[model samples]
Target: MRLAHGLDINHPVHKAMVELGKRLEEKSNGQLIVKLYPSGQLGAERECLELLQIGSLDITKVSAAVLENFVSDYKVLSIPYLFRDRQHSYDFYDSTIGKDLLHKGGDYRLMGLCYYDAGSRSFYTKTKAIGSPDDLEGLKIRVQKSHMAVAMVNQLGGAPTPISWGELYTALQQGVVDGAENNLPSFFTSKHYEVCKYYSFDEHTAVPDILLIGTERWSRLNERERQWLQEAADESAIIQRELWRKAEEEALKTIKKAGVKVNYPDKHPFSEKTRAIMNMFKGDSIAQKLIRNIKSMN
Candidate 1:
């Protein structure tokens, strides 16, 4: 059977996907093969999902935030500061709610296989330090095109510019965007830290990179093949978490050496500013229920 794997090259998700493919091949004894297409070679996240809808692409890695556009229930993970800490995030992902969120995308033809930690997103600016919400005011900040992210930036009083990741460095260097937010590894690996001098560890959002397989493809697999693939993906997630932690540490070291002023800002003010945005979804009982569940978790 022909299987296509879609991902953006240089992304941590792609690194994990490559390892997962290798493991699946070994477990299947080469009977079930996977074709890897990185660097958005197949298509962007939305395009890949469109392909999945029509049964073209077999597998892909999509952000839970992006998934929210199609599967509104997936937006729960996009809520900033919803998790107490990394352990809280991981523990919740292993709970019933996590499983429900993963499967919720199936109604839209995307089936989540596992969650890959993307780490906490923090602000990095080229010429300023975002030590507090007031520091962010009037600054043109770049955020993922998610409504929640854009709203969070707005709540901080900054202009939320939705720029693609590939174009962000140029956007910053050219002064199109004053700053951008992401985890340490991404900021370092993308070399955005080179242009951005200040690294504020506000730990705004802890969105997980979700690995998904098209329901069309999954349904075509035999029970044994499905089990083998699932086990391989699960094992790869374990390996990816270990790799992510090491990457985060290395990124921090590299950025400091590059002259980035690393500051640990008090997140209390930041959280306070964005708290009211949650009210926008109050009418959605499911989302409200998720907020309650997350708050109650340890």
Candidate 2:
């Protein structure tokens, strides 16, 4: 099987994928092989997903934010303040709701294998520290292409600018966008900390990365092969979560050493500011139900 993703080889997610390949090979006794192309060697997340739809790619990892484009149900995962904390997020992923969201992409030719910890996303800025929603006023925030992300930023009083991850560094350098939101590991690994000197832990969202296989490719596998692959994926997710926790800790320490100012702002105001984001989906019964279900988990 061929797997591709846009993350750098040093990323915890990439390391998890490596573990997945190793485990898969061991379980299948060399009958199954996984060829990985990291660092966007094959294409970006969306392109890789498209490849999966056509069976050109066997598997890929994409943010739930991106997956929402194909599977609208995933938009629930992008809602700000959706999960109470890391444990809440994990509980959601392991719950029936999360599992249902994972398989929702089957109609679109994608079969989600498991979730990987991408961590909670927070704001990192260049010129000013975002201590509250008022601080975000008049600022342009770079967001993912997902509508939910744009809506959250807008609701929080910042102008949301959707920019591809590959172009974000230059966008920040050239002042194309004032700041961006991402997890600590990404802020450190992407070197965005160099430009965005302020790291605020508002922890607005805990969107996870979804590991997906092409439905066509999945159907081609024998039952035993499918079992081996699923088991490998499940185990890799556990490994990735531990790796992500350590990475977040190290990223905070390293960014501080690099002179980035980190702050843990009271999250209530940020959460209150973005609460309107939920009502934006009131017309969508499915999304509203998801919101209620997720909140009930907390």
Candidate 3:
């Protein structure tokens, strides 16, 4: 059997997953081989997910923020300050709840295999530094496709602009957007730091990149094949986490050396400002319960 995977190859997670394919081929003794299309060869993250749904692609990885468009339950992961810290987020994702989430994609023809550590997202801006909620007023900030992200930015007094990942560099360069937010490695790897001078460590959200296989593709595998595939994905996730941590540290140092200004602002104001976003879900019993459950994890 042969499978195809797609992702932005520049990322450490994708690099680690490529290793997974090598391991899978070895473990299966040539029963299964995997092909990879990195650097958006398949398309952008959202496009890749859509391809999976239509069975045009066998597998892909996407941030939970993007997945929220397909599975509303994933919005829980996008809630600002959802996880207390990195360790807390790791603990929750390794629990039963995480397994349940991975399976939630089945309803959309997406079979989630595992989650990669994506680190925490914070803001980076071009002309001004965001020291407080007030600093965001009137700034057009690029956010993910997730409504939670748009809501958070809106509540914080900035205009939320949802631009494609590929367009962000130009968006920042042409003043189409004043700034954008993402984890350290992404900000560095994508070279957004070249356009965005100030990096703020508000560390608002921690969204995991989920490796997913199309349900049709998954069903095609026999029990033994499925076991081997799953084992490879599980192990790749472990390696990806370590790679993410090291890349994160390196990104911070590399960008600082690139003449970028780094600021660790008071997070309380940013957090307090976005509290209203969390309340928007209160009317829905299911979402409210989900929030409480995640918060109760630790």
lDDT of 1 by residue, 1-298 (tens): 3334333356566678778889999999997877787756766677777888778888877778777888888777878798889989888777898877888877788898888888999999988888899999899999886888888899988999988776788999999999999898888878888799999999989998888888998999999999989888888888888888888888889889989999999999999998888887878998899889988987
Instruction: Report the candidate with higher lDDT, 1 versus 2.
Output: 2
lDDT of 3 by residue, 1-298 (tens): 3233333567788788887898799889988888887767767888888888888888888889999899888888998888898888888778888888889878899988888999999999999888998998999999988898999999999999999888889999999999999999889889999999999998888988888999988988999999999999988888988899899989999999998999999999888988888777877887787778789987
Give stretches of model 1 more than 4 Å off. Answer: 1-11
Give residue 77's lDDT in candidate 3 (0 to 100).
90
User: Residues 1-298, candidate 2, lDDT per residue (tens digit)?
Assistant: 9999988888999999999999999999999999999988988889999999999999999999999999999988998888878899899888998888888998999999999999999999998788899999999999988999999998899999998888899999999999999999988888999899999999999999999999999999999999999999999999999999999999999999999999999999998988888777878998888888988995
What's the lDDT for all of these models?
0.84, 0.93, 0.86
- TM, every model: 0.94, 0.98, 0.96
* Candidate with best TM-score: 2
> lDDT for model 3, on a 0 to 1 scale?
0.86
Clashes of 1: 1
Order of quality (lDDT)? 2, 3, 1
Q: What lDDT is obtained when candidate 1 is compared to the true structure?
A: 0.84
Best model number under lDDT: 2
Q: What is candidate 2's local distance difference test score?
A: 0.93
